[model samples]
Target: MSNRNKKIIIYICCAFIVAIIFYLFPHFYSTTMREAFIYFPEDDQIEFIDASTNIKLIDTKDENEYYLEWKTASETDKKAYLRQDIGFIFENGVLISTQSEWREKTKKLKNKVTLHGEDSGRYEAITFHFAEVHYPDDIIKSKQIMTEDKHYVIDTPLSPLVDFKKAKSQSEQRGKELLDSIIDQQLTYTVEGLIEQFKINKESYHIFPLTEIAQFQTEPLPSMSQEETNAVIGRMWEGLYRYYLLGTNTFTEETYDPIGNTMPFVFLSKDDTHLLVLYETADKKGQQLLQLIPKSEDNENLSKNEQ
Candidate 1:
C-alpha cells in the first residue's frame, strides 16, 4: 500500500480500537463499581419484619408488635431497626436521609346538654379533632422504587438548605407558568385543584424529614466524648425536625424559603466499626437512590487519614 493509504489504514485501526474501548467502558465501570462497593450480608440478623416477612417499619395490621420489640432491643438492634426501617439501606450499611410524613386533621363541633345548660336554655359545644398520622411504612411506600433495592430522591450536591432553595426556586417558576397557563386557557376549576395539579405533585418532591439518626456509625470512639454525641444529635435533630415540619405542610410558595444554616447529622455505629455521615451531597443521577456497602477497615482508615 502507498504511504498515504497506510496512514489512513492506521488511523482507521486506532479509531476502531477507541470505539471498542468506549463501548466496553460503561460495562467495565459498572462491574468494577459493583464489585468494589456492593457487599451482601450473609445470615444477616432480621431485627424487624412485617407479617409478610418483608423488611418494613411496621406492619399496618400490628404496629404495636414492632414497637414492643423496639422497646427492649439493644442499642445496636435499635440502630439496625431504624436504619433499615427509616434510613436508606444499601447492603450492610444505611444512608441516613431526611424523613417526613403526611399528616391531616379535621375538626368538628357537637352540641352538648348539661343539667345547668338545659335549665338556662343555653347551648354547650364540644370540639373534636381527628388527625392522619403515618409511620415509616407510608413514607417509603410513596417514594419511587428504582429496583427491588433502590429508590429515587431529589439530590443536591450542596448543603440541604441549598437543595431546598433550588427546589423552591424551580417550584415557584413552574408554579407561575402553570398559573399563567390556567389563566390563558380560562379553565374553570377549583383554585385548590389547580394548585394541586400545577404545584405540589407529590411524585416530584419526595419530602424526607430528618427524624432518625440511623445513617451514622453510633459506636462512640474511645476518644469521643458524650458531649460530642449530645452536640451532634442535638444539632441534627433540630434541622431534621424543622425540615420534617416543612415537608408535612402543603407546598405553598412561602414554604420553599430557606430555614437557616444547619449541618447534616452524623453518628457512630454501635460496633464502632464505621463512621457514617449524613448528607455529604449526592449526584443527580440514576434515581438518586442512596445505597451503602460495608466500609472496610482499610478504607475507613484512609477516609479518616484524608480527613
Candidate 2:
C-alpha cells in the first residue's frame, strides 16, 4: 500500500475505537453501578415454588423458615414447568411462616395505618429480623449484647407532650427568614432559640451528649421516595425528628459534655427523606449541620448506619 493510504487507514481505525468506547461507556457504567444496590440473589439461591401475587414462599435450609421472596420478569411466550422461573429483580424479602400465616405470627403488625392501599405508618411492636448471614466464627455472643451497659428504650408508646411555646414563639418571630438564615449561616443558631422552637424539655426528652452517631450525614435508598421516606421516619421515630420539613439544617458546634450544656439542632434533607438529631457542646467553637442527602447506587458512603 502507499504510505499516504496507510496513514489514513490508521487514523480511521483510531477514530473508530474512540467512537466505540464513547458509545459503550454509558451502558457499561449503568450496568455495573446498578448491581451494587439491587437485591438480586444468585442462581444457587433460587428454588422451585408456586407463585402467588408474583411472590413466592421459599424454604431454604439455611433460613429454617419459609419467607416471602419475589422476582420481576417479562410477560411473554414461555415454556411450561413444575415451578415458576425466577425473573429479574429477586429479593428474599419479609418472612412468611411455613405453618401459619405471617400476619398471625406478627403480633406487632396490628394497628396498621393504610394510605392508598399501602400501610402508611403505625405503632407496631414487632421483632426485628437481621439480614446478615454470618458464619459461626463471626457470630457474636448473646451474653455480650445483654451485658452492654449503654441501652436506651421508649418507656411509653406516646411521645411526651412537649410545650412548643418557646419553639413556636421563635418560629413566629423569625418566620421563614429564620430558617433561611440558619441555612446560609451553615447551621449556626442560638442554643436557647432552638430549645424554644422545638420545645425540647429536660423532662420530656432524654438529652444526651452529642456523640459521633448524631454527627453524620445519610441519603435514602433509591427505592424510597422522599415523601415515603419521610413517612417512614415519622412513623418509626418520635419527637422533632419526624416533623422537620425539607431544607431545615440546624447545628451549633459549641461542644459540651453534659446534656444541659449542649445546643440541639435539626438536620433535615432537602427532599425531607432523612434526618439527624445533633447537638453542639458548650465548649466547641464550630458549626455543624445534620446532613441528609438522596441515596444513589453509585454513592460509596451510602451504607452508613441510620437511626
Candidate 3:
C-alpha cells in the first residue's frame, strides 16, 4: 500500500476507536461507579417478579407474614391493608438500584394512599407521595408530594390528607430550635459529629446515617420466622425511641439551604457489632422506622484488624 494510503487508514482506525470509547463511556460509568447494589441478604434469597406477570412473589408457610392477610382477604374486606411492590436492579453480582411502591386503602376514609421510593445508589434516593380521597356526593380529591435536593418540595393547593402547611409550620419551629442548639454547642451533624458524639475512635470505626447506609438491611431475610421478623422490626423502633429522647443526639441538618429540618440518627454499639438507624417516614406524619443494618464484610474485617 502507498504510504499516504497507510497514513489515512491509521487515522481512520484511531478515530473509530475514540468514537467507540466515547459512545460506551457513559454506560460503563453508570454500571460501575454510579450504580450501587443491595447485597444485604444475598441475591438468591430475594425474588423480583414483574407486576405485569401477576405472579405470586412471596410464598411463605407462615400465616403471620404481613401480606398474608391482604392476600387472602376479600376485596371489600381488605381495608387498611397495604400492598407493596419492590424491585431491585443488579449488574454483575451487585445490587445497583432498588425501588418500592406501597399502596394502602382505608374503607372508613374512602381514600387510597401510595408511597414510592427509588434508590439508585448513594445520594440518589427519592421518595414520592400520593393520596386520593373519594368523598360523598361524587367528589374526588388527589394530591402529590415530591422532594427536591433531599428536601420536601410541595406545590400549593396542598392535599387535604397531607397538610404541608402544618408540616411547614412545625418544621420552622423545630428548625429554629435546631439552629439554636447547634449554635449554642457548635455541634456538627455529619459523620464526624456522630463519631464525636459517641466518643468513637475514628481510626477503629466507621459511621454513617441511614441516607448513606447500604440499600437494605442484612437481617430479617425473606421467609424469616414470624417471631424473628417481628423481633428485628421491633428492635428498629426501639432503637429509634431510645435515641430520639430529648437532649440526646437529636439534631437537624440543613439540606441545600439554611432551612433546617430533623434528620435521622444513628446508633453504633460499643463493640461495633450492631448498627441501628432511626429516621422519619416519607409521609412526613411524624412517624419513623427503626432499621438495624449489619456492617459490611469489608468494614467488619477492617474493624477487627484495628481492634
Candidate 4:
C-alpha cells in the first residue's frame, strides 16, 4: 500500500481496536455513560431497578414515617415556602442520577456507593455512603421511601429595599439567606393520599429530620431474627439521633437558591453520613459548590451475589 493508504489503514485499525477495548473494559475505555448503582444491601452486585422520577416527601404521624415540603421565594410578590402533601415511601431512611448498562465486570468494588461522575465526563467515580446496613423485617415493611425534587425555584424579593442595583442585590441576598437558613432546617411533612382519602389516625404519621447527619446504612446481611435486626438498627438509630442533637445533619434537596451564597445541595444519609455544601465566597461568588462526598460502602454481599 502507498504511504497515505497505509496511514488511513492504521487509523481505521486503531479505531476498531479502541472500540473493542471500550466495550469490554468500559472504565478503561468509554467515557460518557457514568451512573450510580445503589444496591439496597451493602454489596457489589446489588442492581438498582429502573423507574420514573415522581418521588415526593411524606409527612409522618408516628416518628417512624416521613413527609415532603418545598421552600422557595417569589419574585413578583413575597414568595412563600409552600408545604403540601406529595408522594412518599416509608423507609428506615431516605435518598439519584441516570441510566447505564455496564454490570458484567471482571472485578468488583464491594460497597454501596454513591458514584460521583467527574467533570472530565470520562470515568465515573462513585463515592460510597456506608459500608453496609442491617434492617429488621418490620422496619422494611413499615418504613416509607422518600424521594428528591428536581425542579426550578423562584427567587422572590425585589425593589424598595434600595435602588435598582441594590434591589437586585437585595433580592439575591434574600434568596441566599433563605437557603442558608434552611441548610440545617429539619424538613418534615405527612404521608400522601392515604390520609386525605381515608380518615387515618393521627398517630400513623411520621417525619424525618432533614439535617446534615440523619443517615442510615444498609448492612451486608439479609433479613435475620428480630432480635438481631433490632439490635443492629438500634445502633444505627442511635447514631442518627446523635447527629440531630449536634445540629450536623444535611438532607439532600436538588434546588436551593437563596441570595445564592449558600452551599445549595446537602444530603443526609440513613447511615448517618454527613454531606455538606462548601462555598468559596460570600457574594458574587465563584461556581465551585459540589458536596465533598465520602464513600460509605456495604459490599459484604459481594461473594453471595456472584452465585
Question: What tens digits encode model 1's per-residue C-alpha lDDT throughout 1-307?
Answer: 8999999999999999978987977345443332111111111232222111012222112211111001101111112211111112221111222212111121211121111100001011111111112235332111100101211112122312111112247654454344336432431232223334434333332222222332222443234443333233333333333332232122232333222112222334444333322331222111111112233454345334433
lDDT of 2: 0.27
RMSD of each: 26.7, 23.1, 24.9, 20.5
Question: Please, what's the RMSD in Å of model 2?
Answer: 23.1
Clashing residue pair totals per candidate (backbone < 3 A) = 12, 10, 3, 65
Over 163-265, each residue of candidate 2 has an lDDT whose tens digit, in order, gives 1112344433343244335432432445445555555443433232221111111443235554334333332222222111111223432222232223234
Q: Could you tell which candidate, 3 or 4, scores higher by lDDT?
A: 3
- Score each candidate by Cα lDDT: 0.26, 0.27, 0.32, 0.27
Highest TM-score scorer: 3
TM-score of 1: 0.19
Better of 1 and 3 by lDDT: 3
Candidate 3's error at 201, in angstroms?
2.4
- TM-score of each predicted structure versus truth: 0.19, 0.20, 0.25, 0.23
Top candidate (lDDT):
3
Clashing pairs in 3: 36-96, 37-95, 37-96
